[model samples]
Target: MNPQALSPRAKRRRRLQQRQTVIYGLLIAGLAVAAAFAYLVFSGTVPSPWTRPITMPEKIETSETMECPPEGAYSVAFGSVKANVFNSSNQQGIAVSVAGTLREYGVTVAEVGNWPKFLRTDGQLQAGKAGIVAAYTLQQVFPTMQVMIDDREDASVDVILGHTYGEQSLIKSGDFPAGVEIVPPAECVPEEEPTEDELNDGGEDLVPEDEETEAPSDGEEDAEA
Candidate 1:
């Protein structure tokens, strides 16, 4: 126990033992730390890039819409319009009859109904700015038809047949404007962005109270005119 009396060899052995003890302690502590980290990773309390599941980046939503006539196009197909035919005359079933005739001429007749409030000598074609070109296209089906602008928001046009609306015989097959490009109506102002309105609304609009359309029964689809 007298340190001064201890041999030099003995002191050296004691120092070596102390060094070994320190090395073993450090090794055990390092192993404990590694074990804790592995437990945390397996329990999902800590994220490990190597062990995590592979995933794709989130998808971004786009606002692009599909329109029938398309945007900023100079011309449109004549009979490509969806028309709502209204009977402003005293004749019964005339609207339905005219709608069938329009369908035969390659126009998509949206609805057939009665609206006697129209007083124009020439049947009027009405739609929002988005449908102006479509309105003009329908006008060829009814040569004396007038194109009127409204506040609605789709490419659908309202064809209010006046008393002077022509008979079936007068609606010629040649009036289909077959393969002919339809220029925008004279009433459509250049500054008025019709095509853009169409895109913004995405070619969809609420129905008007006045439009009580009776669409023909098509087996392919069931939807409004």
Candidate 2:
């Protein structure tokens, strides 16, 4: 194994083999590094370099507006005003009867029952600030009833019938504003009964076939001849 004892071709072959071994080692190391990088990508261990940014829309706020009548100017329809009729009197069925009458006059009656123990009156119309116009309209109907402002928070009026609420006839033509007139109940007309012929029809064909026709009588035959 002396350096000068080897042939030139053999030395050249030995050097080529060493170079090939180094090349194979480098290729194996590169493959191992590539496999490690692929594993990290699949397992989501590191954030991907290619990603997109997301944006969201902003929220908006809005307000609602309504036109109201001028101060002291009462303009409203009877049907738009919600009323509660309570029987304050000891007599029975007054609340129901009065509530029906009010409904006939196009008033929107929300509740009907006995009055609360604390309030007492012959007939009183109670309302809040929002129901002032409605209360005034009802006052025109019950002239003797008192209109009072209370803690009621909605656009509704409370009518408590008192001892003298015997006024059953609400047919009087009051000067109610347009679209607030008294709307009477529609007349119900009963359907006419079916006749005996209609009953015998039985909703089926009744004519005889030509092949099953009967012979004519002597007088009918002479007329035909």
Candidate 3:
């Protein structure tokens, strides 16, 4: 039947129905989009933009002692030792004051800042492969601090103070490094690599993660073809 032949009342009713259909379609589409977004947020597959990332430390274990001295030398003097102080705690300006106290012992304070990446309870003494002994030297003062290994390619160690940090040197009354000495360069011990099982079960992947940086299937498809 032609709409031109319809009564005026019928025409008005027909137009109203078409308008209702269009409105219902839009509402359904909107509902679908909202449902999809909610799934992405709750499924843990996609992070919501408004949510602050909760980075509760899943790993913070003491690194194995590699027994390495400074880059080439076996030992270093207290005055010549290099170190950096970091405050990760909520305390204000604690690192700077600690650095000053560190300088009094003739230790070189390279840099000081607040590092929030690795949060701790007491403190952490971090050193690279070449700075093991340097870290050990700093550990003398802060003996209770835990040791962590970093990837820095230098002999400078870092001391990250945590929430309960009120540490001071144990040698407060001595000649400050009473008998510090300079060790000549010798054959340095290499860091032992962690096995695959250790990588899968240990605290943090650390060095193993570097070996697995590339995706596991990058060249596998082509090789299989």
Candidate 4:
């Protein structure tokens, strides 16, 4: 059984044996890894123990917001314009009071719980992706009140103008208070080329030529002498 004396067939057999041993070892290792992964999947738990009771953030509740009407007595102006506004929507109970004019027809709507976003194309509050949380309850009720844009520097008074909620195209700038006007962003206009008349002629400026001083006539000088 000397190593040097082994035949070619024996050498080939020994090599094959070593290769099979390596393959068997790899196969066992693979099976063990698969088993471990399967266990993780079926355990019905996250890897982290702390994640077991998944925490959800607490939801914020809507609150009341107050805004004054554009005009009239301070006492009479504020309050819910519509009674049903409180009952129907998610709005929080809100009572408006006149704080005074903001700018022209603009008046401050103080104590707004939820910030109002202006929607020019439509008067109604646009539905937010997460849905709107109503923050103000109505003290007065008017289903067909107008919406108007407040010209005030502060954003508190940009109310919808014109027709009420139900009317088709109810919101119009014209419906706003007497002094309030909608100022849309200026649109780009095409630049016009200057006309030929506008160009300077013969080195003379577009401005009127200064009057040239005339040399006194020789005859007039002689007459004076």
For this target, which candidate reaches the highest lDDT against the unseen true structure?
3
Model 1 poorest 10 in a row by lDDT? 57-66
Candidate 1 lDDT tens digits, 1-225: 997788999999989999999999999999999999999999999998686554321222211221123234443564567878887777678778778877877678866777747554656777766886777666666767666666677788887777766664235566354445555544444443556557558667656679967766767565553
lDDT of 3: 0.70
**Per-residue lDDT over 58-173 for candidate 2, one digit per residue giving the tens place of the 0 to 100 score:** 11121121112224455477788789888777889978987887898889987787765433446767766577567767766776666566555677888878876666423345
Show pairs that collide, candidate 2.
Answer: 122-162
Q: lDDT (CA) for every model shown?
A: 0.66, 0.65, 0.70, 0.32
Candidate 3: regions farther than 4 A off: 1-75, 167-171, 175-225
Clashes of 4: 23
RMSD, one per candidate, in order: 28.8, 31.7, 22.4, 24.5
TM-score, cand. 1 vs. native: 0.46
Better of 2 and 3 by TM-score: 3
For candidate 4, give the lDDT of residue 33.
95
lDDT-based ranking, best first? 3, 1, 2, 4
- Model 4: lDDT to the true structure: 0.32
Please report the TM-score between candidate 3 and the true structure. 0.47
Clashes of each: 0, 1, 0, 23
Q: Could you give candidate 4's per-residue lDDT for residues 6-90 as a string of tens digits?
A: 8999999999999999999999999999788768867864263434654321232222222223222122222222111111122
